[model samples]
Target: MKKQELIHLHGLLAEVCNHYEELSGATVAHEEYSELGIRPTSIHKSKTDHKAAVFALADGITNEMTEETKEPVSAAAD
Candidate 1:
């Protein structure tokens, strides 16, 4: 994906984190992401930096979700 597209994805993921926090009333454990010190609006940063931030942010969000979702779901499709 182009840098612009990567940046867009970064922004989208950030928004998802925010929305999830608001809905669940629990902050995501984004220590890794925070340590990176990058933001979606940091357009001056390189694409690689944004990419790393995206991954870290995604990991944080998924970690939170995984902790909350302990039940296994059926794999059979309807």
Candidate 2:
């Protein structure tokens, strides 16, 4: 896939991750921990990991794009 596509995916992933994180935090602030439904801690951990991975991938893609698009420096500018 192209860098632009990867960048788009990365942004979408980040947005999802952010939403999950916010939900997790909000859940934890409540005074009740009902024994029904999914656990907030687990969701938080999962979202944190996913966000980190997405950032790493985005960084790698950025590096690759830069390397592939480097321009030669003009000696006259030196």
Question: Candidate 2 regions off by >4 Å?
Answer: 1-45, 72-78
- Residues 1-78, candidate 1, lDDT per residue (tens digit)? 888999999999999999999999989999999999999999999999999999999999999998988797789999
Clashing pairs in 1: none
lDDT of 2 by residue, 1-78 (tens): 544444455566446545644764531221121222223233433444444455554454445445555696576954
Candidate 1's displacement at residue 32, Å, is: 0.8
For candidate 2, what is the lDDT? 0.44
Looking at model 2, the pairs that clash are none
Number of the predicted model whose TM-score against the real structure is largest: 1
List lDDT for all candidates, in order.
Answer: 0.95, 0.44
- Model 1 alpha-carbon drift over 4 Å, by segment: none
The residue-level lDDT of candidate 1 at 22 comes to 98
Which lDDT value does model 1 have at 59? 99
